[model samples]
Target: MYFILFLVCAALTIIGSLFRLNNLKEIKQPQGNFIGQISLDFEEIIVRTSVKEQIKIRDIKNIDINIRSIKGQYDGYSTSKFYYENGLSNGTENFIIMVLNNGIIKKYQFEYIPEISFLLNQKLIEHYYKIGIMDYLNCVDILGLDKREDWEKFKKLRT
Candidate 1:
């Protein structure tokens, strides 16, 4: 029947069109921003203005920013700040300052803000940064720090 033949042709045409569109989409590559200073890559953030009903969802409402600068050995402090978003998450902003040292990261303060009010555990930060090194290491443990890497055979990067 001519009608059956036409229907078959129509179905095949629709399927072929969808297949072509999908193939084109697959060929497209995703894009993202590269943080040159640090080894971080993130996708471009876009805002969609949708006036939908507000639901009680728990999520990170603040953004934490930290900066550290050191001049010499055994010196330097870190400053941090917290900021809030007024509108939908959109666009990207970044600021960077020189960090002299990042010896130990004990507690990553979520929504951290640099201020007199910003509270941090001084003792915990100090211990996490240095105490672990001495507490659990012998001469064999620090061999990798050696310039010659005397234990190259012993420690093969674990990777």
Candidate 2:
């Protein structure tokens, strides 16, 4: 029937639209001021902002790095405040590094820089190994980190 064919076409169009919207990559634009910096030492991950805070490698619960769009709604108002105060526009991708230590979540947001993001991810992985993968996996759940491949490999090796 024509009605059935029309309904199928309409469903396909809606699905296609949703797929395209989900897959659309956010554009990278110059962002606001850099708020914090992260560096790794022998036993600590030092975060320097207005004040320096050091978190021991053994105390870290989770480390996550992701590209976040400024346009999206954020639970942390500080992120939005910094973005708008620095005169940044919507659709700017921010390189967000979140570290969970002792039940506190510290977020450091910076302008989208691929090299910096890559280095941070590498440093976290390096530090995770120092504490032993088993211990790290115990502290960090499979869903806690964005890098699921590493989690899968470790879980496989453990089994």
Candidate 3:
């Protein structure tokens, strides 16, 4: 009975080791976003989903937003942003990309991933505040958010 128990424990240990190895392999080599992959690295962040949706951006780009009309779909404007890497496409089919200094936030809609959106928004608010109004507005201007209230709200959110 002791021998049988020892064999069972050994088998379990081997199985556990195999499982750990599989997990490590996954971490080392990401399989892409179609399987819903979200990777954050030191220099870049990538978000992808199966439905031909993806967003990849470098850390240096900082926060940016773009508003444009969706073709034959919405009566309102849709945001077009983000720089895709590795041949990934940020098609206008409900995919939105928002890039920032530390990372990028891309999704079908801000409501789709509230947690990620909140985190990115917080980061943008902090970054804008840290750089002061003139510089921040310069960024906002580039993104076409020229309204004074938009800038004011951004500053207010810092508190």
Candidate 4:
């Protein structure tokens, strides 16, 4: 009975590892406003939207991940405005990617998937180093506390 249980556990471990390895290759969102997929392979990163787009790994200038929150309130009238803030709140988490392509900056927004984001970021950083691009990865927090005093207060509160 002990030997049989050990065999079962070993098989489960192999299956779990295989699943994780396959998941690292591609991430897909089949239904949403951004109904597409992002895949990483040897040569390039492919983004499939209504139209398919391919970006060669070597041509990539920089990959930036932006995290921000936007809150909207109605003034008891016909006007509703979204206020962008610098820190996380009870609102939804937004993930924004700013990519520089052919001298133009293109922005893409998607719902945050923490695991997929972290994996993709790690893969990109690895590839960037292989291709001799050192400073290509960046993370930006878009909550608008640009003032030095405000940033200091925010840091203190967080600690």
Model 4, span 1-159: residue lDDT tens: 999999998998787666544543333322445577666555676778899988776666655545543323211211212221221222234543534546655456555444444334544444544454323223113333467775555444323
Clashing pairs in 3: 62-100
Which residues of candidate 1, in runs, are more than 4 Å off? 28-159
Q: Is candidate 2 or candidate 4 better by TM-score?
A: 2
Best candidate (score: TM-score)? 2
- Candidate-wise lDDT, in order: 0.27, 0.52, 0.41, 0.48
Which residue pairs in candidate 4 collide? 85-143, 86-143, 86-144
Q: Give RMSD to native, each candidate.
A: 20.2, 11.1, 18.0, 19.0
lDDT per residue as tens, model 1, 1-159: 999999998998787655544443221221353322221112111222242222111221222223231111121111111111121111122222211124222222121122321123333222322322211123222222354454453233322
Instruction: For each candidate, give its TM-score against the true structure.
Output: 0.18, 0.42, 0.26, 0.40
The runs of at least 3 residues in candidate 4 whose Cα sits more than 4 Å from the true structure, single-residue gaps closed, are: 1-32, 40-42, 69-101, 118-123, 129-159
lDDT of 3 by residue, 1-159 (tens): 999999998998787655544443221212334345444333344555554432333333443333232223222212112211222212223333455445544343312232243234445434544544224654454334567887787657546
State the TM-score for model 4: 0.40
User: What are the clashing pairs of model 1?
Assistant: 80-114, 81-113, 81-114, 82-113
Ranked by TM-score from best down, the candidates are 2, 4, 3, 1
RMSD of 3: 18.0
